[model samples]
Target: MLHVISQDLSSFNTLGLRSNASALVRYEHAGQLPALSQLAQTYKKVFVLGGGSNVVLAPDLSALVVKVESRGVRLVAESSDAWLVEAQAGENWHEFVGSCVDKGWLGLENLALIPGTVGAAPVQNIGAYGVELEQRIQSVTAWNLQECRLVEMNAEACRFSYRDSFFKHEPMGRWLITAVRFRLPKAWKAVLGYPDLRQHAILAAAGENATARQVFDAVCEIRRRKLPDPAVLGNAGSFFKNPVVSPARYEALHKAHEQLVAYPQDNGDYKLAAGWLIDQAGWKGRRMGPVGVHDRQALVLVNHGGATAQDIAQLAQTIRVDVAARFDVVLEQEPVAIA
Candidate 1:
């Protein structure tokens, strides 16, 4: 357990927003749980931080920030075709995906280059290229804050949804995910859930001939081209999730607006493409002050240098309001803002 005071959060958070914490604690090991718990109890308000990817910090922080940094990987079970692997929270998600690629574990390769820690994967139910982390998750090990005990929850119990989980819903802030277990196949089907990936795979001859490594490389290349790196220009990948609505509502919109793009969900719902709507709303590459909508991906709001958190928020709100006015759909942000 590492405790530090007056730590700067700008560098830690990818957005580079200058939010100062009164105190910050780094929990890098599972064994340090007891000490961290005791410290949490001592503090009035506690906030947990992981990859610093999907968050926008307020200018002033009112709680003690605990950075969950636990790190490791364990292969607990194995069979001829699959393995039950556990990874500590601090393990960089992309690095872990690379490791799985090296081992020929097939589930995570398409999600390569996704930022944040393993523990955060389930929280957002992080999805890309037709694959979500929840589909690969076996279970999650978390610290129950109210009970002050460590507990394990199976995949079903996690109540996975698009960019959501049990931790994000019921009894919010009730637990801190410590480690996540994933059961991946050594030899498996590489699902091209998204049409774009499917076409890309076909172009690369990614049918039965493509290996997991090729798929990972191809997906990473695709993402690199589609999404701007926040390290270079400030922006979160897809600031808002694709909105899921009833099939009837989707069809209604489709009939009215023939250009609207949507994907049918398994449960008879339809996932509306937020990007297509935002781009149609004429926000792409539009600049205001220091913030602007990314030219390539309108769903992403960019901070084109000297942009403050408020400026980004304002621009995003404008886009949301415009989209909402044009279509009857209300936009929701994917990033968690702590004010």
Candidate 2:
């Protein structure tokens, strides 16, 4: 089992801020379930953490952080075309994708290089480069702290939406996911729906053809060049999710702002590009104290130096208010705020 007796948690989080925890518990395996669960009874402040990819703290949280590190994978079924595989929660997400790629699995190629762990993937229904994790998810096995038993939750039960899931809404901090099961295909089928990805794949193939592996490689290259490395430059990826707006509202905005780029959703709505909007408003590379919006993608607010959690919040508020006033649209942050 994982153990932590230190009062400070500066190194543990990706944000690189010095904060204290009353106590920190790390679970290296699922077998440590009872011990980890027992802490909730003894402590008032408790939270589950993954790779620290999508969170901003109000302060070095004074809670007991249960760092779930259950790690492993097992293949439950396989055929010529597809394989059913289950991965433990703590497995680093991109590394897990890399393993599947090395094994010639085609489904996860489009989601390469996303931060966080497998267990946390389903919570946000993490997506990228025209693919979402929900497409490959078969079911998730979680330890329901309320019921004190293991339960298998299917995709529908997960309630996935654009960057949201059941765990993100209802039953919010109740169940801790232990493992995730995915049904991956052996045959490559590249999803080139996203314009930039398609263009990249086409350019790379010289108008011939690009496979899933090629698409994955191209997407990784794009992300690496566009986004700063979190390990080197503290960030939580995209700080704001692309906002989904109704079609009529989109039309009005389009008429008002002709240059606005939006994607029409199946539900007769539109998903506006938050990054473009932020950049248009001139927030990119703007700094206040040690935190600011990323120079490349304004949606990604970054921490440059000794930025407290409140520093991140203040910058976000300014962006939100300005964007709302200028465009008449509300921008919602993608990262989890632990205040």
Candidate 3:
């Protein structure tokens, strides 16, 4: 059975933008998805919502909003080499990570404190501290809206990339992720490549010997210092995706601006820091109406209070135009924009 409600979505989205959903449906089990899909057939448009941490809802959403709230986590399989952990779509990402670490599952330690749900992770290919969701993803179970059936997709089939997946592109709205399974290696090793994590590990005197719990704690601390809690201040965490450029382009930028922050990629491209670019454009801590760039981290855009979706869109566009003019690079927004 599907429970539909007409409600204001301001409380649902992290941005806290004023919006209204024509119809909203909440599902607590995978078995309900097929019926929900059938219910969606009655609507002109349908949109699936997760934890609402990575989206900008339009003021008037003339669509059926499906909120996934299915929840559970368990060890599905184990071998001599690895442990297969599975979690339902609606489980809180940070909580799930913490639970895994508590149980001695180590791979998700570096991704601690990331917002949103397990289902949304694969869609965004969420990453932090040199660890990405794709790295641990063994498989995904989803409801295929097009064929009106359930299907499973492996990591490679998801076409994981930098902040993107097949879920975000080709099959976009056709698949509703219900659960995700991760492969945690038995021989756990710390991912200390990220500077912040490395520094924290050193400061804590854990270094290479840091347990999964220590890494999780360090990540939480780092994130707490850098990002404002959405409950206290509205934000979508890293509004813009770091732009990747060719080695030649990076060299040219480096020559012009010696302090330009960038990281060398495995494929020879350079991932320029979007925050540095935004700060260079003089948008950090700057406010335009109800929207502003966060002072501590320029990559974040904050809602002062009572901001409209249009206001946020305008502010983002202005920043984009200015960054392009100054750096000849376009900064793409991380959150999905509903219109």
Candidate 4:
């Protein structure tokens, strides 16, 4: 069964911006997606919404907003080298990762506290603690809205790259991801190369032998200390993506600004820390009207209260302009601005 309601979306989005969708459709089962897609045809536009962690909606959405609420988690298969687990799109991401750790599954520990739903994970190729969702993803099951059929795509077919995927590019909005399948290694090896994780490993005395639970706890602790809780202060985590530049450009910038923070990629490119650039540009903790840059983490944009989407967008633009002027690097927003 599907329920349709006209509602305020301020409570849905993590940023707490006030917005109203013309009509919202809620579906709890993947089987309902086909009907939902058919219903969408009656509207001029349709928008798929998940946990609402990565979107900033306009003042009024004239389209039909489909809220995915399907939920389940189960082991699909076990091979000699790995375990295949599947989770519905609507499952809370952190909770799913925690469940994996509790069940002795190891690969998702590093992505502990990332905010969003499982289905939204592949759309952004969510990454943290040096481990990305793409690394553990085996396949994705989706409802092809365009063709009105169910479809499955292997990880490679997703074309994942640095916070991007085919779902976010060419095939955007044509498919609604119903669930994700992850391949967790049986011979679990901890990923501790990330700086904060390494430091926490030393503090916990786990080092290279850290259990998946320990790593998960450490990652959660680090995230808690750095990012503001949306419950306390409205925010979409890591508001901008780190800018990647050529090695020669990085070298030139390094010589000019000796303290430029960056990490070299395997392809010889360099990912400059967007937070460092924004902070250096003097945007950290700066506020205008009802929105501002987060005090603790410059990468976050916060809505103080009663702020509109335009207020947040303006603040972001100001910061981007300043960062570009200061560092000559362009910062790309991580959140999707729905208009």
CA lDDT of each candidate?
0.83, 0.82, 0.90, 0.89
Question: For candidate 3, lDDT tens digit of each residue in 87-174?
Answer: 9999999999999988988799889988999999999999998888899999999898766898889999999999999889853457
RMSD (Å) of each candidate, 1 decimal = 1.7, 1.8, 1.1, 1.1
lDDT of 1 at 62: 71
* lDDT per residue as tens, model 2, 127-228: 987788898999998886545678899999988888999898854447889999999987666777887785774544644466656776788888998998
Off by over 4 Å in 2: 1-4, 201-203, 206-208
Q: lDDT of candidate 3 vs native?
A: 0.90
TM-score per model over all chains = 0.95, 0.95, 0.98, 0.98
Candidate 4: tens digits of C-alpha lDDT, residues 131-209:
9899999999988876799889999999999999988875335778899999999998888877788777443497666
lDDT of 1 at 4: 62
Candidate 2 local accuracy as lDDT? 0.82
Instruction: Choose the strongest candidate by lDDT.
Output: 3
Question: After best superposition, candidate 3 residue 71: deviation in angstroms?
Answer: 0.6
User: Against the true structure, candidate 1 has what lDDT?
Assistant: 0.83
Q: On a 0 to 100 scale, what is the lDDT of residue 214 in model 4? A: 84
Backbone collisions counted per model:
0, 0, 0, 0
After TM-score superposition, what is the CA distance of residue 268 in candidate 4 from its true location, in Å? 0.7
- After TM-score superposition, the amount by which residue 233's alpha carbon in candidate 2 deviates from its true location, in angstroms, is 1.1
Could you arrange the candidates by lDDT from highest to lowest? 3, 4, 1, 2
Query: Candidate 2 vs candidate 4: which has greater lDDT?
Result: 4
What is the lDDT for 31 in model 4?
71
